[model samples]
Target chain A: MTEQRTRRIDVPVLARVEGEGALEVTIRDGRIAHLALRIFEPPRLFERFLVGHHYSELPDLVARICGICPVAYQMSALDAIERLFAPDRQSPPARWVQRMRRLFYCGEWMQSHALHIHLLAAPDFLGFDSAPAMAARYGAELRRGLALQALGNRIISLFGARSVHPVGARAGGFRRAPSLQQAGALAAQAEQAVPAAEDLVRWTAALPLPAHPQQFNCVSLRHPAEYPMIGERIVAESGLDISVDDFEDHITEFQVPHSTALHALLEGKPYLVGPLARLNLNLDRLHPGVKALLAELDIEFPSHDMYHSIVARAVEILQALLEAREILADYAPQEPAHIDLQPRAGIARGASEAPRGLLWHRYDLDSAGIIAHARIVPPTSQNQPRIEADLADALVGVGLDEDEATLRHAGEMVIRNYDPCISCATHFLRLTLDR
Target chain B: MTMPPKPPAIGARRPRLAVHKFSSCDGCQLSLLNAGESLLALAERVDIVHFAEAGIVDEHAEADIALVEGSISTPEEQTRIQAVRSRSRWILSIGACATAGGPQALRNLGDSADWIASVYRRPDWISALPASSAIGAHVPVELELPGCPVSTEQVLAALTSLLAGAAPLTEQDKVCLECKRRGQVCVLVTKGEPCLGPVTVTGCGALCPGLGRDCYGCYGPAENPEVATLAERFGDLGLDAHAVARRFMYQQSGAQPFHRAARDWRQRARPAAPPAPGAESGAAPGPQPDGSTDSHD
Candidate 1:
């Protein structure tokens, strides 16, 4: 009788990120039997706690959800609640305020993506244990990436009034708009970052990706004028086009047994949304220079491999930088930062491109403009099922024993690829793997 | 003469800092990045040994100074905080979630199971324990930086203190103090609104009031707030005790002191236990289908 094999991978220490996580994979007889990315962090549900609060407080409240993408939370919450109170969308922010908002988002993308590519994603492909280790060996690549990220932060802080959650964005408009001097200062920095960002993209394009292709229903904002940011309709590669108001109609969120977050299915199916989706669907909307650079990379639209997300992120970095420059150039202090929002009682839905992906929020308000009910679906939660699918596929294809280190690394890479913000997922762990 | 041996420093290496996250929005940690160039400069002075958001490759790396973000929700997290506590020399809790269990702690106020069922389809797969609590509740936190997302300047200053081997600094006063300092007229007095600024802490720089709105209390309550006077004042402004209590419970519903005060006032104002849980976990205290407050309220 063959011994019933017990394969388990326990990553006591998860490297290359900001939080605490442990990944476990159990295999019996070579076929995959179990997989769990145990996040044993405490629960901090900002949504449920947001009750009875003024709609104006939401951006600040939700901003506490995660530190990396406070702007993402702030922007999404503001867009959603603003639409809820003002159904007609009467108080659209001025073009300059809108521009500043986009520029801030670009800074986040640059900082986040660079961190992912050089500090998070690069180590996995190069067979190194971590990015810092990779940096130690490839000093030039690491330095350039860091410089690019710093420049991105510089731009983001210019309009955000601070990094993380900027206090400037309110329901009607900014608390205060950036002075012309500030905009000009950011433009000068953007000029230096443009070439460097381009260089990073071209360099990343050369990295070898595993030849594993899976279908992804790329979803992003479809703006006719330019790349989507503050307000736009959502479009996906799978022939689903819906305004942010109708997001719930097409995408249904369900609770999964394995996770705390509500898994979202587009028309009852899993779909992709985030940087790759944004870059692929809105390629034509990119700046001419970015378009030229995209041509040089020779990457086709709707690239199937999830690994290509890095490349897509690079393209986005360029697009974001170019967009930021345009927004800054047209800066006009005279423009109103906010508009009058008369809160009418009803349901309002809004969607916006976060640095990570598309974030959607739904709010049901009473006659007094008080929120009666609220539902939020973040990008990472939507991507969890897809991540599990990809991880399972990788495990089956490899056909190796469940070696702890190998399984752990593979699992971390998969989760990190999506940049799974667990805070966004459950909002809502102690990792307990019952063997 | 032989060269004098290098004098040994009390602490050989710079205090390694590890930033940890559990269930949170990730805003406070992002504040470090939000610091712009200062973040990089700070990074140079002290090693950011471990930060998931900053993309530190080794999650298990040890640190002398550990800045914790988010609340403890799951049983696994309960155990993880113990480990995080063991690894670091000093643990500083950042943001509301760490210092006060955050708004997510609202789950602890009621049936967490209900939340799990309502929000998720497969409740069995989720391993979370019903109530999210503050990091200090579970771990020995050395310092607490309270805010929805703490200010970048605070973060920078905290790092500076750690590098210099001094304690991280914070104010004991409320947003009202800053409001007074800024010479802004009182929104509560003028607009007949209920502002948490009198009770809430000051780190946010009286932002909401400066915009002609009442403070939502992102900085948590001031040390020893005079709640009775504030409640009386609120009633004077035409808001009932219930409305005043509800507004006070807004963002920091999970923080015990505030949660308790709000519930106590509401119960006193209303003779009976409300049909629904008031400020309980998972049961959103918002109006029911009939547009009335739930039992928890």
Candidate 2:
């Protein structure tokens, strides 16, 4: 008679992700039976709390959703509310306003991506307990990464006054505009850091990554001429294109038993978003210099491998640095930094690519511009389902007989690849096994 | 330019520093990582034992100083905080969420269960406390740093002070004091803007007022805030009673002074219709009971 045994791998607390979570995998008779990326973080209930706030307060209020990507939240809220104020979209915002918004977004991408690549994700690749431990060996590399991040923060401060939860962005535009001198300083810093960003691309590309290529349905915003950052039409690799207003038709969120965060699925299946998706969908839209650098480095494009996100993020840092310099060079102090507008009763939706992935917001406003109904879908929440699907696939190859530490490390690596901001998800796994 | 002095070594064993999170945006903790070059320097001086965002998890490790972010909003978190307090030598509550329950504490105003049911389809699966509370409510805090997201320089200063065996320097003065020092014109007096600088705390370098806008009070309340006076002044600037109350209650809603000021304005905004004449005069509606001092006897 053969005996059947059940083995369980439980991670009580997942480290390195933005917020609190756990992973529980149950192996029954040498096969993966159950897997859950449980997010037990206490729900902050941001959507409910936003119900009674005035439209003018949305920018500052939504920015508190996630610290690492406050700019993303503020920008998305502004985009949504502005649409309600100007439904025609015939009179676009001023050229200066558009340029400044991109500049602010560039700062966020640089700071957020640099933090992920250096401090959060690098430890996994280097076999260190943490970034501080990795710093002892890779001090110079870490220094360059941090310096680039500081430059990003400096640009944010130029417009927003402070990096974290900046108050510069409002409904119509920024509260104030940066002078030519401030722009000049940012330009000089960006120009100096361009080489470092380029180095980061090459450095991350050279990291030892496990090649586990699989087809993924990539989704991101697509602009006609520019690399999509602000607001644009949503595009998917599987021939799905829709306006921002039509996002609810294509993507649906549902509650799961184990997690507080609602899992987002595209057409009833897991889909990928963020840097990897952005690059795969908009590689041609990248700057000429960025394209040339990619070619020179001999890295293949349209990669299905999830680990390539690190390299994609590095490429984005380089692109952001170059773009920031160009914008700063062309910047001039424009009069009336913001245009005043009165809010009317209407419903609108706005979506933007956050440092992590697509962040979408919808608002139904009353006649007095008070929020009637509000819905926010952060990138992390959308990515949670895809992360779980990827984990299930990755763990199948690992032998059931492997030690617990090795199994847990493999699981953590898989989760960190998405740079899951469980904090943004606001959203656990406890393991129970039956033998 | 002179370089800042290196952080002095405390003893033969490096002092362990652990950072814990409860319910926050993770911005305050990120500020520590965003210190860039100085972060590496600080790393050399102290042993960072537990910082989950940085991929270091040692929750049970004893530490010399523990910097905690966010607020407690769950039963599990409530128990976890007590455990954190037991293991740490000194606990520094960082950010507005840790010091004053943050913006999410607005849920304390109404029923949290109703809020949860409105958002979630299956509210039974969700487990949360009725109110989001600051760390001080759960455990004794050695220090409190207040901000929507704490300033990185302030974080470094606090860490440096602890290493040097000195108290962290903080200004108990209002943001108005910093605005004066920076030689900035008062937005409230000159522009008629409803700035909270008069009652808000310093440490943000009077950022909003410097940027040609009204101060939104991201750094919570200052010592001895004349909140009623400021609320009345905001009303004078064309903000209605409700708007004035919101201004005080927005970011640091859980703080005692801000909470009281907001409540008072709410009462003043719509007085309760004089309580229907003699309803509050202790008059019996249907039948009067016989008034007797020794009825039982």
Candidate 3:
């Protein structure tokens, strides 16, 4: 074998991403030898911190975990605490309130998905280094995505009172439900967002996609009724069905050296979790339009080529917006914002579809409504191993020198495929392959 | 037009900006990207020498503006933070983790080694430091922007001010001030809820109180927080001392002053005194007479 030249494409700064991380690739004999997505964010130990705190304060406390998807955290925490109050029974929250909360979570997905698709993922599809550059060519598309994201924020602000880490989410339910007019206004905003979302789905579908199918264990919440949101059972790509309580049994967390976040293995195997997982497991649960759109895009599971994450996110954005409009159209003002909760003094587990993927929460509350112990598994941590695996697989057969721009671009594509939240890793990007 | 006055220089590197990480959720650094329109403008002014989350390629030794997020946990991070401090001219710590060890600091109260053993199947593979501490504990932090995921606007304001050679403005007052200003009803007094607003810092702007809930204290403690007095006040809100103390130990457990005061109060409030000596002598050292003992005395 002939010796090959290698160059280093070190990302001192990562952009359009939520957290901090670096991507390193190595080349030997003109073939990709190694790739490591190093996420060095300090671990805040949120699970450790939740110990000794009151159950009432957990939603707000953990809400600080992600700036983009605070509602997801808030909703999952509420679900867990609510389980303590009514473990075997359904919640007493008014139907309208439940409807509104689901809509609120949809708003989060719309904004987060649009931002990821347009500002972060779009650059890779277009031949640009960043969204700012992409904007020069597709200003209308960028603006439309911004509008869609802004509409999602508007809905969140309606019931949540603020877009990021809203004050409304609590152990019981929202502190205050939006007035009919406020809900109506939000619904109106989302109504306008549907077309833009549809446009995004179509645009993303038109992009060049690499066809490679990697066996993946897609994990998500399974709901028999409407698409799973705040309520459902956890399921995986491999026909493993289990309640959220069995999550610890199925997926075990282990601390790895390259990343600060503890990665989880499903039955000692690396698996995939995120939008793709959700769409694949809940294909029957989506809004008809979204389901049709998914079929149109031909995005069935076990497919390799992580770039499809962008397309999946875009489709979800459309579904979220469509769901938001429906919930808002039937807005009812007098619904109880919360159901009275009495902590059951037992371990309660809850997992919700966060914009990124399944956000899992386990709370061990005491008799007096105080939290005895807590375990939180953010989507990013669940996806860590899959990210490393994909990077390794993508690196194969590529003959670019490690320092070569092509190798670096391929490395980023692998990362962007999972839309890996390295900030969630250190704790969690947009892409450009610089030639 | 004087070329926008060429950003205020710190050193030969045109203030090469380097973003560093520790034990954290990377939320605070993401605040930089969340800056949106303002970020593009800010990027033009600063060299943005190194930001891994946003993907810039610059040597760590060359950064001038070092934005450190998260807390120090691993031994490697201890050394890495020092290296970061040496490289950057202005080290601005962002978020609660950087300023006061963040939520992860809860490990400082317990044995982190035990935590690793409990969480991981093979603890030997896990290499971590004994405790998690704020970035300022090791290096001189020129400024601090404290929050769970430092506020985006605050990040922009701090960077803009620093670039203009001005001191960053901060609300050192308590969250109570923002709540009162907003005319939100006191959740603790009226609703009989436990609140940290009286003593906790005010970055979240009394958001929880405005929603009829108590403050979770994501912003950490206020300047010169009278935590003991606040703990006493919690008694008035129908909470026991233990319940009151639990608030400070929640999200901002790393805040040394607040966490220590709370723990001390907890240790002082035991109703059960130690058991008699011979009554449980060979029985695993029963409680001592005073209730203060080395493993039940």
Q: Best candidate, lDDT-wise? A: 2
TM-scores for all predictions? 0.84, 0.93, 0.85
Query: Would you give the TM-score of chain B in model 2?
Result: 0.87
Q: Model 1, range A371-413, lDDT digits (tens) per residue? A: 5566777887677667777777877765656456666667777
Give candidate 1's error at residue B232 in angstroms. 4.2
Q: What lDDT does candidate 2 reach at residue B240? A: 74
Candidates 1 and 3 compared by TM-score, better number: 3
Question: Judged by lDDT relative to the true structure, which candidate is superior, 1 or 2?
Answer: 2
Question: What are the per-residue Cα lDDT tens digits for candidate 2 across A1-435?
Answer: 324878899998888888889999998887779999999878887876676568898877888888999999999988888766873444444556777889999999999999999988988888897888898899999899999988888888888899999978877778888888888888888888888999899999899887788878999999999999988899999999999999988888877889987788899889999999999999999999899899977569898989899999999999888999899987887667777787888897898899998998898887777676778888877888899888888887566667878888988998989988887876311111211
**Residue B34 displacement (Å), model 3:** 2.8
Judged by DockQ cut-offs, the docking class of candidate 1 is acceptable
Top candidate, metric DockQ: 2
lDDT of 3 by residue, A153-186 (tens): 7778777666766677765667787788887777
Candidate 2 residue runs with Cα over 4 Å from true position: A1-3, A87-93, A427-435, B1-11, B270-297
Q: Candidate 3 docking: what grade? A: incorrect
Ranking by DockQ: 2, 1, 3
What's the lDDT for residue A154 in model 3?
74
lDDT of 1 by residue, B186-232 (tens): 88878776888888879878877776667777677777777668877
Alpha-carbon lDDT, every model: 0.69, 0.82, 0.70
**lDDT of model number 2:** 0.82
